[model samples]
Target: MMSKLLKNRYLILRRIVQITILALYFGANAYGWKVLVGNLSYSKFLQAIPLADPFTVLQMLAAGAVVGVDVLVGAVVIAVFYGLIGGRAFCSWVCPINMVTDLANWLRRKLKIDRDARRINISRRFRYWALGTLLVVSFVVGAAAYEFVNPIGFFVRGLLFSIGFGWTLILAIFLFDLLILKHGWCGYICPVGATYSLIGSKSLIRVEHNHLNCTNCGNCKEVCPEKQVLNPVIYRKSGFINGIECTNCGRCIEVCNDNALKFSIRSFLKNN
Candidate 1:
């Protein structure tokens, strides 16, 4: 049991963080706890410091809304924070929908459903296109388009408020990831994720690969959500996994038996 816990520490920590964020949001809504108020799209820290999702702000801008100064500052704070660490860290560490998709992925592995699975061929780049389309729609429709149907919003708000279509949408995401494709929603469809990936493209914290220690067991890639990010560095050369899509979730590091992969500060001095 101790060994298992140690092995899955990062996963455990991620769950804790995700749940705690939700709990804080729920508490703020229900009991007026002001530590962290508001939803993921726009949150107020300690009721003074604002933290807005930069992408949501962009959608508002596209819709030609008069965004407030506080919201703009909040967006900058979030963008800079993620830019220093990693952007999609929001996907793994904070987003409520990640729990649903991760559960689907876990079930796929346990049931051996992923083995020899004939998966759909959705390009990961589709997320960028989706992001572009959403902005266009926001511009045309004069509203933040994705906000109406965002699964993350549904999952979070549904939990805080009354149940409606949110639960159904959340369930569909789970099923889509489980049966339709692997890493489908966040990888291929989420514009919010695409925006974050772009923001953290040159993040300081990154997973560094020491190929000399790699035994080629393939455990890291097997567990990585974005396995493509591992391809250029794993067994190829000792370098940073510099892909913008990497969530820095530490799954590869946790699963690797040879200690070939670990987190390190990215060196901007070198071209890596």
Candidate 2:
């Protein structure tokens, strides 16, 4: 178990970050800590700084609503963050829904189910389409239409407030990951993730593959949730993992016993 934990060091670190952030929200609510309050869409930190999701802000704009300065500042802060790191990093490191999907994926493997057989056919553009549709709906309805169905919001509310249809939405996601698709929610359908990916498509920081040390053992691929993002970087002499799909979760680096992969700036990537 110790050896296994060491090998999955990044994965463990991701869980800790995700749990800690959520715990702080609960802390604010249940204990009146007030360090951080509100959901992912909006948050107040230390009763001073406000944080808001850019996508949510866009929805509000489409609805022709007023955005406060604090909310705008918070959105910029988040944008700068995901812009520097990878945007999809939010999916792997911050979103609470990732834990549910990941758990279903793990259980699917443990049950000896053939993943390829259960996986459904879906275009990657579905997320972009979903994103466009959401904006249109928000414009038409003069409200954040997608917020009504967003599972991330549901998960946070369900956790801190009361259980309602949120549990059903979450359970449906778990079943979808296990029975219909390998990465159905975040990969193919999440508008929030799609929006962030666009924001960080040219992120400076990325995982660099040390082609000199690689043995093509394929452990990295086996552990990677976004396998296609690694293909060019690993095999085709690409500069870095340039795809917006990459979350910088570092699972590839973690499972590589040979130290063939590590985080570095895109400019520092070695050519084959």
Candidate 3:
């Protein structure tokens, strides 16, 4: 019963987030309210949020003497609040990219095709290779190489572009999701996911698996989008799961019929 309730809540949250993203896309483009918030140019907003282009923060970090304390603080706060709150919960729940990914997964499931690419027999090292390439390109070329692959950008372009072109692009993503890869764009391609995973390693909030209650029925493994829960290393851990790849989607917890899973937070400093 509890598991069902959590699943329902997840579905509700997913729909609400998708609706919000669609509204924001149309609202920002149609009404220009995004401009009102920060006087930020469209290109500037894209640069700041997704592309991380121009590498302003990296440049600041490189200049070790006079660091931008304000920027650092803002970045830290966002990372902790979002990243540390159960890995990639922000991505799966709030990110515009995730909305599109969910759509892709749905299309794939409808077609009876594998939606995730990670199921392929490629070495896990491929993720590292992709990450390296994205970082090098971002730094060297001063271009948002990963932005072109970003689902958020794709969704934005889909909404703002000509209807024919926009729908075409969306359809292409849907087809790719159905035919080519499961979470192909998200798991291996998304630089944002990679970045979040790195910062979220230290996250206080995480999933806890109760081995005593867990029957090892593998429901969580079967339902996991990222398949991180099934890894031998994670399965061996006690109580809270600390895998960096965990997205905190709560799917595992939601599906655990035995109520063997939960979310927990650990404090860094003990009270005196």
TM-scores for all predictions: 0.97, 0.93, 0.72
Candidate 1 lDDT over 73-140, as tens digits, reads 99999999998766569989998888899999888888888777886887999999999999999999
lDDT per residue, candidate 3, 124-176, as tens digits?
A: 34565676676666566565455544455556566655444445555665565
CA RMSD, predictions in order: 1.1, 2.3, 5.7
Model 2 stretches astray by more than 4 angstroms: 115-119, 268-272
Please give the lDDT score for candidate 1: 0.89
Who wins the TM-score comparison?
A: 1
Candidate 2, 228: how far from true, in Å? 1.9
lDDT of 1 at 220: 90
- Identify the superior model by lDDT, candidate 2 or candidate 3: 2
State the local distance difference test value for candidate 2.
0.83
Ranking by lDDT: 1, 2, 3
Summarize candidate 2's per-residue lDDT along 1-272 as a digit string, tens digits: 99898888889999999998899999989999888898899999889888888899889888998978988898888888888765578889999999998898777777755535645678878999999989999999999888988899999988899868678999999998777777778778999988888888777778877777888888888767677788877755535677788888898888887877888886423322
Backbone clash total, candidate 3: 4
lDDT of model 1 at residue 218? 91
**Where is the poorest 10-residue window by lDDT in model 2?**
263-272
- Please list all clashing residue pairs in model 1, or write none if there are none: none
